[model samples]
Target: MEFNFGWEMLLLFFAAAALAGFIDSIAGGGGLIGIPVLLLSGLPPINALATNKVQGMAGSFTASMTMIKKGVVDFNKIWFAAFMSFIGATLGTICVHYIDVSVLDILVPIVLIMIGLYFLLVPNIGDVEKKPRMQEKLFNTTVVPGIGFYDGIFGPGTGSFFSLSNIALRGQQIITATGNAKVFNFASNIAAVVVFVVSGKVVWLVGGVMIIGQILGAYLGSLMVIKNGSKLIRPLVVVMCFLMVARYLYGKF
Candidate 1:
């Protein structure tokens, strides 16, 4: 369900997508930027959201690949977790309506606020590795699929959730943690895109335009993260989490 907007409009949205990708590469919540622009471009809400995922997948892929090339992340290590995340998201999509999201809708923002606070309060939290609170196998089996399921069901803050899980449970530094988060985030996005595409809700024309910008921005943002580490990541993650909290809360009140 693609719409025929002018190149001028497409360019405007492309810039927004680029900004989204830049922020998303550091933290998560690119949708906080991309989705609004898509909506403003006159697409229906569902179409805008689906298209945002389309472009977002591009950003995630770009950032993930850049990290892999830079030796910051080893895809081989997290392959199984990525697979589990993908499968969980697919299942979550299939079971979307069967699950009651009312509780989740309320519970999620509160959790996001707490996460935001954690980042703000503990400045040195993710700068270096800490003792793992969860086992690797256990984290892979549980948190990976858990966040992926949440991604499919509610569709926001998946990256921050993944990054936090990696840092807190896997004892990863924030930069590497963010890179690992992108992989699973990409996997979950694939599941989302598949479901959205099958439902014919995506506006590919808009998505295609935004994707170019996403790629460029994600690449640059990933480079900065590589150079600067948590100094760049912490503030952005903080901003994105609170922004995500605001977005979710706005839906309620």
Candidate 2:
């Protein structure tokens, strides 16, 4: 598809994608920047979403690879979760064509607020790994798929959900959970990108430019997560969750 984006608009999108990648690599809500920027550049909502997926995939892949190379992600433990998440996202994408997601418009913001508050109030929740309250099998089968479905259906805080579940249920340290979260996030993103590609909605030129920014931003953000650990991730997670809540509320009302 041909787009008439001015040079200034292109630069704005590049900057936005960079910022989105940085935030998403840390806490996941990159769409907040990506989708809006695409819309502002005059694309329709569906095209914007599809194009955002392309850029988001770039960011997620970069972050996931960085975490893996840094030895922060445990591939053996996350393989099952990643597979389940991919399947769940594919199903969710199919379901979106038939189901009314407006129900989530109200529910998701409430859930996001609660999640943000939970992290904010609990001073030391994700500071260190704890004993598992939920088994790996249960978490992989239930929590992983559920969050993946949510990402496919109505994505905003998927990363935060994954990280929180890993910490609260599976006894993973904050940094470790964030790293593992990227694995599943990448899987789900790939699933979404496939659907978008088939539908022919992706704007390759714009996506290509944004991807360059995504790569650089994702690399830097992953490094921060590796070095700062929970000290950096916790606050960012909380902030992103609240931002998601505000974005949803704005969209709804």
Candidate 3:
């Protein structure tokens, strides 16, 4: 595929990336904004998804770094989980061609809706830490990689899944969950990036500009999460979840 994007289109991508990064850093579903813009810009589906992953990784990396600097993410505890996520993502990417993903097409939106509802209706969820429903070791071993695998296969609400599971099962505060989600999401993204790069689907020029935008947007969003915690993240999570659902429905139907 050949892309000769002019300044106007370049600026448009940068704007979309910045906005997506900001929202993604806070609540996930940045792809809902980013992917459509990529497609609209005339890249084929594979190139768009591939290029979007590049920018997405940059946003996740920036968000993770910001949170890590603020000491919200515990590197020691999440290191193993990140490794598991990487492994899961690699397998999922390789298996994507072989697997039947139609079930996921139906199930994921329902799961995202439930996650959104859980955050919406639950009082004081992720406000203060409670006794964890799942042990940290078990959660890292199972749920972390499970969500990573899902992301590699069909990514849309991966961030929400990470944040929600961290909060609901692991009993972390929203700020903490969001921070950890970035690390896990970044780990999962690495495997996908390698695949895309090998297949020559990525557009480096578009990805380069978008990376700059994502870094800026993710940094600002991370600051907001650090300052406001659940007050900011909760509402965005709900909104992003619904947006992800709509994206999935539109694609499928």
Candidate 2 yields a Cα-based lDDT of 0.88
TM-score of 2: 0.97
- Tens digit of lDDT per residue, candidate 3, span 193-248? 99898999999999999999999999999999999999989998999899889878
The digit string of per-residue lDDT tens for model 1 on 1-253 reads 4368887998998899899999999999999899888887788898988889889999999999999999999999999999989988988887897977778877888888888888889869778888898888998898999899888888788899999889888889899999999999999889999878899888877888899999999999999999999888988888889989888788779
Find the 10 residues in a row with the least total lDDT in model 1: 1-10
Residue 131 in model 2: lDDT = 96
User: How does candidate 3 fare on TM-score?
Assistant: 0.98
Measured against the true structure, the TM-scores of the candidates, in listed sequence, are 0.97, 0.97, 0.98
User: RMSD to native for every prediction?
Assistant: 1.2, 1.1, 0.8
lDDT of 2 by residue, 1-253 (tens): 6787777877888889999999999988898899988997889898999999999889999999999999999787689999999988988888988999988877888888888998889988778789999989999999899889988887788888888888889989888899999889999877789989998999888888899989989999999999998888888888999998888788867
User: For model 2, where is the 10-residue window of minimal lDDT?
Assistant: 1-10
Which one is best on lDDT? 3
Best by TM-score: 3
